[model samples]
Target: MTIIRSLSEVSDNYRALFVDLWGCVHDGVRPIPGAVEALRAYRKTGGRVILVTNSPRPRAGVAKQIAGFGVTEDAYDDIATSGDSARVAMFRGAVGNKVWHLGPDHDAGFFEVPAILTDPAVIERVPLEQAEGIVCTGPFDPLADPSVMRPQFLAAKTRGLKLLCANPDIVVDRGETREWCAGALAQLYTEMGGESLYFGKPHPPIYDLARRRLGAIEDIGDSSILAIGDGPLTDAAGAMGEDLDLLFISGGLGAEETGTAIGGDPDPEKLDRYLAETGVVPTYTIGTLR
Candidate 1:
């Protein structure tokens, strides 16, 4: 794959971009250096930017959160979130009317009814014993190991409760610390024979929503759009699945594996080996967004 220093080298080719949020634009706590400029510069060239994220928040919530990180409105056109996608399913009774929440209180927005569903099912958060299914936004404690939920998952499995996973990210590096996400819990539940439904990256529903959002702006085809992100499994897999070209940022989640140094490019040999091991071959590679 080609390794370049800035997104400008190839930004002219695509009419739009499907950009990942966490690792590509920011490190969770703050904005990454030059990421904002890169996005704004692309927008100046008339490229529509869709912040397609695996964040388990509605588009409005994501916008508010990113704005606090210095990502202004000028950087992108629209957003499509995994939370928005999964919420539609929830309102449609993908799990059931009564669901047991597995995440913390911050993610209670997952239970909100979407505006698109006029006749939405009335959802209620009940105890595990009274729950008809499960709505998992993330772990109750992200730092804790996912194995702690094995007993609960076994119980849910026994009762045949389906788990609707909002975020499919296994982990994200918040500044310098890594934290587990909902995907870990969903994976554990599935391993214990409990059905788990995913709505985030590497899944089709979020992409479908992203495309529809982009289509609302202009008629941009898959080949004319570039997908930029840091997740090898989620971003790369999602791009490959949709037959879209990818600009893989090795400095995010796979920084150590790809031997990418801070504010520098990845080690070519190590990046190659890592890509080969992961079985993800992107159209391009870069260390940082700019």
Candidate 2:
């Protein structure tokens, strides 16, 4: 792959960028070195930057967390979270509809419509027939019995209820540890013949929303936008599916340890070996975008 010593090479080629949050711009706790400056430089050159994250929280909440990390509101044009997209789908399809949630209560914010909220304690008391659709945001209790979840999925399927998945990722970084996500639960429900719609990375709608958010400030072409991320299944897949330039960050999903490369430029044989194993040939490779 092409080793870019500076961001200037791609600067003129793109008018806007949809930057990833966790590994690209910041760790869970803080911004990476030159991340703010790189974005500032891009903006100074008239490039619009949109921070796109797989955060399950609402966009407003995501922005607040970013601000807490010392990233000022002026650093980027707009921010979009997976929670926002899931909320969009819920409002469109399940308005005034009752929802049976299999995830945490924090995810309740996504269904803040006031009509869909149901207590887990009351799930056994309430008939499954009363629920509208199955919304899996994530596991309420990570250590909770997976077998206990089967009945919920089966009940939803038997009733022809819709399923909405907030985060498409099966796992995500929590501090230095990786934890399971709503997608894993969604996958289980899918195997049970339950119809489910997902929101987040590797989905076109979130990318489209991110594009629109960026477009408000400056023009961006599909060819000029670059997707920098660490997940082969979601971030990388999404970028490739959209046919955009991509720079894959290693070690996010253990791809650095196990993954193959695809079609890309000159790089070390070791890198080629890693890329070959991962099947995610990035335009560039780095330990971290910082």
Candidate 3:
């Protein structure tokens, strides 16, 4: 893979860029250094930047969260989130009406529509057998161990309830700590023979929504649309699945296994082996967004 030191090295080739938010642009608490500037620079060159994220919150909520991290409005053209996609699916009756929410209060807005039944407290009190499906926006408490939700997941699995994972991210960096996400729970449910539907990265629905949004802003082709992100499972896999080129940020998630120290070059042997094992190779690898 080509190793890029900066985004400017290859920004000119793509017309529309789908940039991952949390790991690439920020660390959930603060903005990553030079990330916002790199996006601003790309936009100045007439490239359309879409902040594509696996955040379980709606696009507006994600935008608000990022803004607090110092990512200005001009950095990107628009935002698309998995929560928005899940809302669409729920509204269209694709995920059913009676739903049990498995996330915290911050993501409650994802089920605010009239068509879906998602009273957090009520759902928790009611038996899993009564709910049609489960909507997991994120872990009930990101700081808690994933095993904390194992009993509930097991209960839901026994009932044969479908799980709709709004965010397909397994984990995210909260400051310097790693926190589990909804994807981890959904994965556990799938392993236990329960059915699950993911709304975010490595899935087609979110990418389809992003493509339509980009198409409306510019006449772009698959080859000219670049996906920039930090996760091999989510970003790289999603880009390859969608037939889009990728600029993988090596210093983010999976950095330890790749032997890539934050803000440093990746170990070629380790990176190659990891890519081979995952079967998700990026067009290029960069140490950071800049």
Candidate 4:
């Protein structure tokens, strides 16, 4: 694989790109430096770039949130979130089946299939045996205590209902706050002997969705399309599975321990150690695009 620096370094080969939203372009609150410029430049070159995110919100909802961060819809060709993919998957498989909504209310919009929002009061009376599957977006602030959530998973485990995780992200740092994602809940549920299906990134469905959305007008081959993000498990893994080039940003997912962008005294060594341990080698590793 080719290791490089700067977004400009990747200007030549790629004709299309699938950029991640949360970490690569923005941090859920604001846009990252050079991200907008890089995307604009890529578009200027007649390249197709699509923004894909694991946010547990529908495409329209996510578009509104992105607009809130000053990211206009014109920045990329299209946007696809895990929530949209999950709902599509759910609707494709079973229609009108009841689902146990297990995430934030904002994500509840994904499940239009007779979903029962996991309200605190309702949990007392409602049995997991009643639902067809559990649609999980992320941790519930009211039920994030684990003690309460575990019981729900336990109930689902006994019934053999699916736990479809809308967002497969394990954790995400919203500005200064780091919180768990649906993947974390799914991990716990899986440990409790429940089946979980991830909807975004690393999964083929979302990748195919992103590719279709990007348009790929230039007919770019595998090496000419890049997947850029900060997370190894999601972005890099997605690129690997899709046979696309990857640009892994270190500064977004984890805080800069060495106080550097790409690598410095401690950061470079730490990155090396992480790559060694995970065995997920990326085409490029940088601190930030700027």
Let me know the TM-score candidate 2 reaches against the reference structure. Answer: 0.82
Evaluate all candidate structures by whole-model CA lDDT and list the values in order.
0.94, 0.70, 0.83, 0.73
lDDT of 1 at 36: 91
Off by over 4 Å in 2: 5-9, 94-96, 113-129, 142-148, 255-270
Off by over 4 Å in 3: 114-129
Q: Please rank every candidate by TM-score, starting with the best.
A: 1, 3, 4, 2
Better-scoring candidate (lDDT), 1 or 4: 1
Best by lDDT: 1
* Candidates, ranked, lDDT: 1, 3, 4, 2
Worst 10 residues of 2 by lDDT: 117-126
Question: Number of clashes in every candidate structure?
Answer: 0, 11, 0, 1
Two-way TM-score contest, 3 vs 4, winner: 3
Candidate 4: residue 107 Cα off by (Å): 1.7
Name the best candidate (by TM-score). Answer: 1
> Residue 255 CA error for candidate 3 (Å)?
2.0
